[model samples]
Target chain A: MKNLKLIIQREYLSRVKKKSFIITTLITPLAIGLFIFVLGFILSYSDSEKKTIAVVDHSGIFNKPADLAKSGNTSFELVDATVEELKANFEDTNFDAILYIPEIKNLYAQSHTIFFYSEKSPSLDLEMVLSNRVKNKIRNFKIKELNLNQKELDALNTSVDLDPEPISDTAKDKSKHTNAVAAGLGGFMGFIMYLTVFIYGMMVLRSVMEEKTNRIVEVMISSVKPFELMLGKIIGVGGVGLTQLAVWAILIPIIQIIASMFWGIDTSDINQLSMDQAGIDQEDVMGEFSMIMSEIANQNWWSIIPLFLFYFLGGYLLYASMFAAVGSAIGDDMTEGQALTIPITIPVAIAFYIMIVTVQSPNSNLAIFSSIFPLFSPIVMPARLAFEPPIWQMILSIVVLIGTCLFFTWVAGRIYRIGILMYGKKASFKELFRWFFKQY
Target chain B: MNSILSVQQVSKHYGDYTAVNNISFELKPGQLFGLLGPNGAGKTSLIRMMTTITSIDEGSIFFNQEKINSDTPGLIGYMPEERGLYKKMKVGDQLLYLAQLKGLSKKDAKAKIQSWLDRFEINDWWNKEINELSKGMQQKIQFISTVVHEPKLLILDEPFSGLDPINTNLIKSEIFRLKEAGTTIIFSTHRMEQVEEICEEIMLVNKGRAILKGNLQEIRNQYKKNLYEITLDQSPADLSNLPGNIQEQVDNQIIIHLEDDAMSNEILSFFTKQGIRIRSFKEILPSLNEIFIQSVEEVEA
Candidate 1:
């Protein structure tokens, strides 16, 4: 027990003290924030360049140039010129493009193809804005010709706001808004779990390979059991993973708070700036934002956080032990390591894909089975947790996951005991199986 | 006195291939015992079993008159032939970790590491990573890590392989000092001369079997052929009908091989009757290297 503790301490401290670990832990959140900021900035400014379009209309629907509306960066003006003349000399004039509206034989036609001639193609946003304006004008003309009541027509358009509530008396009350928030949270948690498993599990593998290739395993085995060494390493790397997660959780919010205090550059400020620049209604965005915040507040975090931690640890242990075994099996050949690692990574990658699907259909048969399956549950089950998966399913999944973790860890210990000391020869999957059954 | 370690017919096998075959040996307290064997002669296998890194297939091993088990590792120090230390770890931290793994408390490990670093006069190297140190410096650290816990039995395999002569002597003296402090030392190497100088009792293993075992001097005496070299004052006029067969003669000295029943006095009397002055006479015993090769070849044959 003391040896195990020492091994774990050495494994944990050695990695935690590395310059790379410190730099990465400190810099990643800032880099992500900077990236989001730059992206939003670029999106708001991408269409800032203004352009003028000259319209030669013969359809008489848009009778006056003053009735034509300007949207965003594109402005429209009526020109008293023929289509041929505008097309021939549109670039010579100040206008960026010439729009020709041909005479329509039927005002109530299902579709009308208009012509836009320019040296460069118009932006999709500009095209959509122009079409919507013309469609609205024609609709008004028809409405006036038909003598339709605008008030009655406006009142006739109805939208259904769905409130999904459980019919069962035992089921907890969950609003649709809360469900949306839960799905988003579940996705984020699942993604974090996936990243934790891959990053930290690979860390365990590299550490094991380092000890094996360095031939330190011989000395280490002489002092402690291989099982102790393996378990210590898995737990140690897992601790590093938890430490990194905790630091990020605390650091990102603190950094945001500091940035807002110093520069008034919080996320909401950026969102507001981008929304204003894009001509979106601030009230709608703020309303949605507050709704999301309230829904997040309404979540049962006391249960969710613990479940997230449980799945994260369970998934990490399951994969990290297998990774350690692969590391031990690998000799000096790097290609062999890659070959051995593929089996472990394939399931993780598949589980990530299944998680994406599970978020969309939380109660699907595929989601239920995968969430219950030990290999996929760590990722898929957490994604379904927010939807309040049946309590029995969660319990079964947790039990299976824990049992499988113990089983794999034992198997890995067996392989590792023989593999670490077995050098020169690259081990195959068959050989690992043999070692698993071989007595030491 | 009861032996500190006793291996009674211990064996190890890998599938159909036998690594160690019914090998038995004992080490007395404070004895510098040599485990001599050629490469692939099961020296490492036997050591692994002794250290409890691998289980014995047959027979039993006892340490301090108690049956060997998991706890026996804590009482044994092992430095494998393949020397290794964590390259990115500081020397002081690495030694402390290894010592702690061997059942030393953190405080004790720290104190012992500090004392060892001070004794080696490398106190400044406490914070330096193993990779930054020279090979000899790393070797010294490896040695310190092995002995920091102060086990009752110390097993060193090719301990001086990478050491410079100066560091080699330093480690050698420390090893001697440890043995003098009543630690039974197993010095395993194929280097015959060093074994001859350091080991009092030795076992020669070939093809996974002990072909020779006893005190070093006694073994040498047992393998000695009745051969003698005599330095004469002058060359003999005729060499016919000598008491012994002349193996080699150069100038005034002659080496003779005698029958098992022959006496040395006969040759001396024959020389005196020949009116030749005899300066000195001594028996010649075979070197350990010759005996090792001969025994191994015999086994192979």
Candidate 2:
């Protein structure tokens, strides 16, 4: 036990003290801040270039164009000219383009196509704006000619929002709005879990390979058991992973504050501007944002956080042991390392893909089975946690994951004990299997 | 004296191949022992079993008369043929880690590491990374790491392979110092001259079996043929009718192979009868190199 602790201390401190670790930990948040700043800068300047379009409505319905709905960066002006004359002398005019609306013989036609003539193609936004304004004017004229009450017709249109609520006693308190929030949060959690497993699992693999290639394993194993060395490394690297995550969790918000103070890029202001452009009410958006926030606040985080951590650690250990085995089996040949790593990575990749599907339909049979299966549960189960997967499924998943982790660690320990000593020969899957089963 | 370490019919097999077959030996405390073997001759396998890095397939190993187990590793210091330290780690930190792994407390490890560095006159190298040092310097550090914990038994495999003459002498003095302080040392190498100079007892292994072992001088004497070298004051005119077969004649010295019935006194008297003054006469024994090769070849044949 003391040897294990010493090994863990060496492994942890050696890595944590590296300059590369410190640099990466501090630079990642700054990089993210820089990216956001650039994005905001581009978005605020995207529509600064203005364009003018001359409207020649021969149908005379748009005689008063001042009342037409206007889009940002574009304005429409009524003109008294034929399409042919405008096309011939468009450069002579100050307008960027000419919108020609032909005279309509039947006002109740199903559809009408208008032409916008210019040397260059008109922007899609400008086209949509002009077409919508014309369409609304024609509709209003039709309503007036038919003697229809606009207020009553507007009232007749109805929208239905079907909010589902589970009748089960366990899920009696869950709301549809909460379910939406859960889906988003669950998918994010699953993605984070996937990244953690891949990144830290690979770290363990490379650390093992370093020891083997450096010829340090023999000296190390002489003092401590191979199993202790491996376990200590896994736990130690896991600690580093946790440290990095904690640092990021704290640094990202602090970086965002400093960035906002410097550039004055108020995200909420951007949201408000977009909302105003979309013709949405400020009160409606604020109400929706608060409801989502409240839904997040009302969640059972005590259970969810602990369960997430369990799955995160469980999945990391399971894959990390397999990676360590492959690292030991690989003797100088990196191509062989890749071949051995494929088997371990395939399951992780598959779990991530299934997580995407599981979040969409949390109650599907595939989701239920995969959530309970030990291999995929680390990712899939957490994805369904916010959706409140059945209590039994979560418990079974945790139990199976822990059991598999222990089994793999044992098996990997066997392979490592032999692999670290065997050199000059590339180990195939057959060789690893033989080592795994060989008596010690 | 009780044996510090004893191996009894220990064996290790890798699938169909036998690495160490029924090998047994014992080492007295404070003895500088040599474990000599050719490449792939099961020397490493035997050392690993003794160090508890691998299990004994068929027999048992006892350290200080207690059956070897996990705790035995703390009492043994092993430096493998292929040995290295973490290149990115500082000398002091790396040595401290290795010492702590051998069951030393942190404070003791730190103090021992500092004293070792001061002894080596490399106190400034405590903060230097292993990669920044030259190969000979790294070798010195590796040797220090092995002995810092001060184990009862030290096993060094090819410890002098990469060292320069100066560094080799430095490590050699340290090995002697440790042995003088009552540490049993097992020096494994195929280099015979060093063994002849340093080792008191020796074991020669070939093809996973011990072909020769015992006190170094006794083994040499046992393998010596009936050969003798004689040096006269001058070269004799009539060299014919000598009692033994002449092996080689160089100036005043003559090396002859004697038959079973012939004697060295008889050869001296013959030179005296020929009116030649005899200056020196001695029997010639084989060197450890010749004995090692001949034994291995005899086993092969």
Model 1 misplaced stretches (Cα beyond 4 Å):
A48-50, A55-76, A81-93, A102-105, A253-286, B230-237, B241-243, B250-253, B259-282, B296-301
Count clashes in each candidate, considering only residues at least 3 apart in sequence or on different chains.
Answer: 0, 0
The residue-by-residue lDDT of candidate 1 on B19-55, one tens digit each, is: 8999999999999999998889899999999999888
Report lDDT per candidate: 0.87, 0.88
Candidate 1 has an lDDT of 0.87
**lDDT tens per residue, model 2, A1-440:** 88888878878888888999999999999999998788778666545667788888877678554645467877778888887887788778888888888877676787987888877786655566677778877777778767899999999988676677668878566555777898888899999989999999999999998899999999999999999999999999998988998899899999988998899997666787677557678997898789889999987899999999899899999999999999999967788799899999998899999999988999999999988888798888889999888888888888899999999999999999989888887789999999998876
The best candidate by DockQ is: 2
Instruction: Encode model 2's per-residue lDDT on B1-301: one tens digit a residue.
Output: 8999999999999889998999999999999999998888899999999998988899999999999998999999999998999999989889989999999998999999899999999999988999999999999889988999999999999999999899989999999999999999999998888888899999999879999999999998788887899999998888898889999999999999887635777898899998999899988989998999998888888
